[model samples]
Target: MASPDGNHRHPETNGEAKPPAPKKQKLSTSITDSEIQSEFSHHDASVARINNGSFGSCPQSIISAQQRWQLRFLRQPDSFYFNDLKAGILESREFIRSLINADDVSEVSIVDNATTAAAVVLQQIAWGFTEGRFQKGDVAVMLHYAYGAVKKSMEAYVTRAGGRVVEVQLPFPVSSKEEIITEFRRALERGKENGQRIRLAVIDHVTSMPSVVIPVKELVKICREEDVDQVFVDAAHGIGCVDVDVKEIGADFYTSNLHKWFFSPPSVAFLYCRRSAKLSDLHHPVVSHEYGNGLAIESAWIGTRDYSAQLVVPSVLEFVNRFEGGIEGIKKRNHEQVVRMGEMLAKSWGTQLGCPPDMCSSMVMIGLPWCLGITSERDTLKLRVHLRDRFAVEVPIYYRAPKEGEVDPVTGYARISHQVYNKVEDYERFRDAINKLVGDKFTCASLSA
Candidate 1:
């Protein structure tokens, strides 16, 4: 069933047990660009699966490894849980620790996803409110563009404790990093002026909709300067998409979804706590047998759940190394691909990029042509479905209402993501679809929005 040391091991049987199979070999140098889709062969070839940033695609080999783990668990549930699960999780944590350059292995814990991690952190802070470490009217800060789930967690946990949430209205179509820093500082200063004590600040490593890379380290410094008590970085799009060194960022808590960019299976992510973080107060959202144990132990077995995804981490690492320069090289290549495609689409549509190239990672936002008449946020849903169902293009479309002193009342954008499997023809198909839609005088009225 499960291996104590986390290596794949078949359960003993009547002289028929087998050793774990060797890892799949890396792609040959002779593999062509057209053949790259074979690596993730399970994905639909007819539709252009460009939205890799949403939920990452796993290689076939890694999928096989995970299936093997699942079979082992099914073969002997008791042995797997009592013996193999803990060590397997520990092994996964070590891999993530090295990947993100965490300060210590004890500081890293695996959660179901970024949302669960957010709940864990917010729950700790909420308990602090109960314990008098924080008082009512204390504030927790987040960005206007933070993930919806994270914002909800804050509202549920923080507000229940009589704490307040302040959303920093981060500027979209941002011109430079300075604009973001200035806006964030202004938000903190405004809170202070209102006689509020800022207890926590949540920073997005890379925003989801209208996707852009945030200057997290600089923002954390701003939090310190403002005397904010703690910093939690919600880097749902961080791990494989950007350079994430939790130690370098200097945040109290950081979380990123391996399923989003690190090519792991769904529902796998890592939460990192600084060595100086208040571990005593930090606990998983769900309390179990290991309640009083550390976050690692408490999070390890959250009661009868599939641990196969976390167990497949080593296979994921092996799959990643198959690429030319490992994760770093893969990120660089993806950045270039997405940027080039974004520019091409922008040029074709007579529009511009939402942010400068430097502000993007593997995903880039290209402004949708005004001719499409996507005038409000409500139109995004209908138009997005239209693109997917009719045009067979899968990319996220975002709509922004006009800000003060802006000319346009509405703006729409398409955020495109590039992965190893994506090719030029995928983006070309998107460009052509949008162009055709514009030529046909597509409008919000047509969408009945």
Candidate 2:
């Protein structure tokens, strides 16, 4: 019942792209990877639940920490009416900062999710400025890989400001690092015409759809050379999967959600504002306490709601270390799992990797063609449902539409996650399920080889 979005491939009964090759059918009753893929099952019946959700709701290490906080919610550790919640938030930010190797934790601000982080940064840029911050035609460039919601936000921002958004047409399964770096450079150059100096280049460190890890250092350099006003990295997927030190990347602004990959509670994210950036106008997503000085966002951090999720961040870091593997060990394990899954999925479905295996970060996006054999855009919903109903798997998919003569070499892709609880079998089952849904006889000879 899932429909394709405008950005993805249109429905076609026939085209050059082909369906996957069918595999022999077998019964599946277990949670093993093979069973999940080959068997026609469902996700709802597969596992325990939390927060009325699946992945984020799992009762894990971080939840234990939240329990401790809940036992004492009324009692603030500080001497005031509240306990030491402020101190707790600081500690959480510090924990995240240390892992990412950031120089100052002060630059980090807590939020509910990655989207909030994006809104905050955009708000600061859109409203935090004096009239001098921008001239009439100044442009901001966003990527096609950005989450759809973020794209919508940018659209509204530009339309209101008399500015424009130029989407960088990126290629998937890119062959070389040079190509990625070049694409970013070209994007900035494209935004520089009409006296618009590409005022801001809001890019994704690890794009959500394909989960491609960008070379931020080089891209930042390009933006600077292009006289782009700022570089904002929406690193929603990069936080836990890879090293995300804001100082190291030198992006003017950055945001990451702890809930997605970090396994931290939902509604928790952080923003990293470069020291010199003018953040005087973070007006609080919701007007809570008055933020007078330039420290509005940071000051507003204390506004409301139970700060339990943000407070639990430190515990999540500790838990990641508790794996006995430490942070490095956790990262390696996760990265390996994703890569392993990507290889198998490509083989089973006959589709090619959407991004380089190395570019993947414990999360992968593998391409899919239209049902009619035409290279199409991504149909994440259909993939999600098929994986669950037929394979008992639960994962996200992203679709991209073909652009005019630039027919997408590959369109639909399923973005896979390999978190701590995931096993090799989980990936195997995912591949099998894809074969079942897409029906095995498929090929992408031009790209796969």
lDDT (10s digit) by residue, model 1, range 1-449: 43532555444232122323334346666435555567777899899988998888887777778888888789999977766677677767877888888756788889999999999889888987888987788889898999989888998999989898888888878899999888898889776776879988999999999798999999998888878888999999998899999878989999999988888988799899887745557888889988867787788888987888998887788777777777888899999989999999999988899899999999999998876777677888889889899989998889987667966433899989998888899999999998899888888668754
In order, what lDDT does every prediction score? 0.84, 0.61
Task: Pick out the ten consecutive residues of candidate 1 with the lowest summed lDDT.
Answer: 12-21
Instruction: Estimate, for each residue in 1-449, the C-alpha lDDT of model 2 and write its tens digit.
Output: 11111111122121112222212223233133453222223324363111111234333445666766765564553431132544455556656666666666656667777677777666655652335567666778887777887887776565466666788877776666688777776777777766665767888888766678878777887777777777888887766677776776888778887776676777687777777735435544655544543332343254656777876765565445444455566678778877777778887767777777778776777765444233433335544554565567777766665657754345667777776555567777766655654566433322221
Evaluated at residue 93, the lDDT of candidate 1 is 80
Among the numbered candidates, top lDDT falls to 1
Cα error, candidate 2, residue 297 (Å): 6.3
Candidate 2's C-alpha runs over 4 A off are 1-59, 74-81, 128-132, 277-281, 293-303, 369-380, 400-410, 438-449
- Using TM-score as the measure, the top candidate is 1
Q: In model 2, what lDDT does residue 260 have?
A: 69
